[model samples]
Target: MKFTKPFLVLATMLLISSCNSIPKNQEKVISLKNAYQKDFYIGSALDTNQIKEKDAGVSSLIAKEFNSITAENCMKSMFIHPEKDKFDFKMTDNFVAFGEKHKMFIHGHTLLWHSQLAPWIAQIKDSAAMTNAMTNHISTIVGKYKGRINSWDVVNEALNEDGTLRKTVFLDTYGKEYLTLAFKLAAKADPKTDLYYNDYNLCQPTKRKGAVALVKNLQKNGAKIDGVGEQGHWNLTSPSLDEIEKTILDFSALGLKVSFTELDISVLPNPWDVVGADVNQKSEASEKMNPYPNGLPDAVQIQLAARYEAIFKLFTKHQDKIDRVTLWGVNDGQSWLNDWPIKGRTNYPLLFNREFKPKSAYNSVMSLKETKK
Candidate 1:
């Protein structure tokens, strides 16, 4: 039917309105959280800056992409209990509030780790005193976040590369029994929170064997072992896909949830012998090491995308056994890799760039879920 100019315009407006009214689910979905909504929770570790909502953009991306959050440093023993008698929960309280505000799953980074322990912990001479101190620390900290936190890295990096327990003060004083003691204390403090043994280099056969034995022993002693976290601090190469998959399968075989905790893919050079995530290890910065000081080359960026895609592909494959895959940082600029091994070096290792924009790697991972459809 022929219509006047005003009627035609009205007709066109109505059509546009009807199209816009289409359901949100019918739209082109391209979010990391939406992509993996069925697979597992996508998580990122937040430092004080982000937890305090320093940048609205960073916080927005976090609330948009991630469904789980871990404190990068605030929840650590060093930060939570800096002084012998004092326990600081100010920043951590804010962190937990942020997670709760966003309705995100909260994961406590660690209860015990040799590196970041307060100085007094290392100075305790008597075995009874040391044991009492540890009990107090775990009880107080874990008790504070008892019901709020969803999981805790009960013990971190407890094994040496050679498949032996690291001689930390806890191990030195209580021997291997220290591990079970820690878990037992955590279980008592928060029966609802999932307790985990988190460590780096778990993909290595020797380390994997050690982790298996550790978990079995925890189970043997009737400790409440809930999950194991394999820190995914890998690069474009190394730690073959088979190795990662094997670690996941092996850890899952224990009937405990597995997490790819601290996930990042550093696109920088490392010393020939540097392997595993030992915070103490350092290599002097050099021109050769920081080749991408200015920016990642296109080729390297492509490789980074592929690396992340491959990792997520494996995550999807083992969705049943995996609980969460948490990136170590929110974005490349905030990534610890920049200053870790060698200070003052630029490294691109996260799914987002310095500006909080999703990189090709982010798209690559999101595409995995789309392709499955």
Candidate 2:
């Protein structure tokens, strides 16, 4: 009650110091002046929230990475067939137009996918009707955007965990031959668009082996397939450097361009304390029982950044083998990390910080020694 003026000033200074010590939202505030930017392409998904004509973040990313945009879910069958007899071209058109205006390359997410297909596609008993419907859909939608989309996920997620053909409307009706037909159909629709088979966990040996065989088989048949999309949804550790390098080499030997598509490495708190969780999960985990904390400790965050550096380093070494590098989502806010593997848990596996600013991964990527020589 009787404090002197000096004591009050000291108290105020201490309070201010503590407040400044707290970590603020630094992720979103990126400087447009980062000089070490790479010429390698950078892109994120375009959604309802991000479709605005004047998005500074999007614009900056476009300015920095040159708008190599990826269509997220719109080109999929689900959005196309929300109702029959009527196809929605709103988002697809917007995506293509955005890329055109920005003079950036656009990727057509998919011509065929098992998870996001329409319900009615499976009911057709007549094989011809089914084939016609598929052909019509691809020829219409993809063909409509023909000269626009530079690359296409001609088929997405068609393989099961064991690399066997997944049972979906496409396989059941068109049989295993549908994949080949789909690629050929896509090629015919747009002879110039690069056709790709895109999927996740491609770095794993078991899955990579299957994909290699599949791509080689497609090549033998003279399918105009152009590339492989390795969805890099990696964990903190799981896939070792050996696995990823071998994977890149294995796919490259197929004479198909390789793209590290949909890449995002999660660096969130490890839930090792949970019951029935594997103790020795990934090579990077420090402990099996409780791998993650509320905020990732500084030590682990450094490892996370190093991991990003290592991946990019590998990418640089194999730059000749890669065609494009696309992240899964635009930012952490839109990432699938929220509901995947462990639903409802906070995950931090992206280049942008939670605040949308670039993280250490950004610096590491920019600092990577280009191996293009």
Candidate 3:
């Protein structure tokens, strides 16, 4: 039978309505790793709960968004090698397995750090004893995960603000040669793994110069150093983009890859005198410091989104010179800032909220390449 105009119009209308009724969940979910896969690896530091997959939501979110992983604390000296004669790999083994299961790039946090030393290590006073301890620590840990770990932060926060080496137990016992010694030991353990010198406040000219000289010294001594990690634990306004760009240029000039490790933009009031990520620093919590105890205000949320957008734009601009960008933690609830500088205070710092949902900042970062296209 020949269809009439009214019948044909009704059928067409029903088809259009059916198409519009498609479920919202059917749309593609954007993965952070896929967005910048060509530029650099997208990573996050995993805490103990995440490593064990205790919370299915947390584990699923990590596998979906990130292409790389770092242990937030398990691999550190105090935890891994709690005793000079004993080494624990229970949690560390699980962390590495999680990364390998997802086929993600695994990075070991640090080999030799001034802070987080085992009690026995700190008590040692003799030079020979310290040398033997350092050698045992580096060789044991690095050799354990040789090929499984892609890179290691061989030396972390070794320099002070004045462009001078901080007088840690390692430095006091071994002198300036300790930096060279650590890298050399790491290279001997894992000849193929990349070794890095990581530090905070590296954007400052003096500290940046100190890092440059440190890397140069290691080079002069024929140590294997492949990259530098500028721990980007920045706040809402400081460390101007110009300073960040200059840092990228300066570090890249040394012929080493630059990584923005442990990045998070804290939306909290910081004490005026506090600087760098010194774990020892502490301040009493008060109402003024914990202004947004309930939740972040709409206006402040918008500002946080803008801040993240500006930072990611810079990263994309210099993707060639950069190697990786790893957020400090998976979500705000797990952020170290909550207890750091001030205890029992709320802080919103990561791209995801406490509920594991992507916030405005996540959208701003994910939409970057789209706008460019």
Model 1's TM-score against the true structure: 0.95
Most accurate candidate by lDDT: 3
Please provide, for model 1 over 1-373, each residue's C-alpha lDDT reduced to its tens digit, 9 standing for 90 to 100: 7789999999999999998997664655567878888889899999889999988977888999999999999878788898789999999999999999999999998889999788888777767987898899999999988899999999999999988999899887778889999999999999999999999999999999999999999999999999999999998897999999999999999999999999999898888877888998898878998898778899998999999899889889999999999999999999989987888899999999998888999889877876655
Q: Which ten residues in a row have the lowest lDDT in candidate 3?
A: 22-31
Better of 1 and 2 by lDDT: 1
Clashing pairs in 1: none
Alpha-carbon runs more than 4 Å astray in model 3: 1-29
The clash number for model 3 is 0
Arrange candidates by lDDT, highest first: which order?
A: 3, 1, 2
RMSD of every candidate to native, in Å, equals 2.4, 11.1, 4.4
Clashing pairs in 3: none
Candidate 2 residue-wise lDDT, 228-333, digit = tens: 9988877778578888888878888888888877888876554554311121223233333234535556786687789988987787677788878887776666
Off by over 4 Å in 1: 1-26
Root-mean-square deviation of Cα positions for candidate 2 versus the true structure, in angstroms: 11.1
Q: What is residue 289's positional error in candidate 3, in angstroms?
A: 1.1
How much lDDT does each candidate structure score? 0.91, 0.72, 0.92
Give candidate 2 misplaced runs (Cα > 4 Å).
1-39, 53-58, 268-295, 369-373
- lDDT value for model 3: 0.92
| Candidate 3 per-residue lDDT over residues 145-227, each given as its tens digit | 98999999999899988889998998888789998889999999999999999999999999999999999999999999999
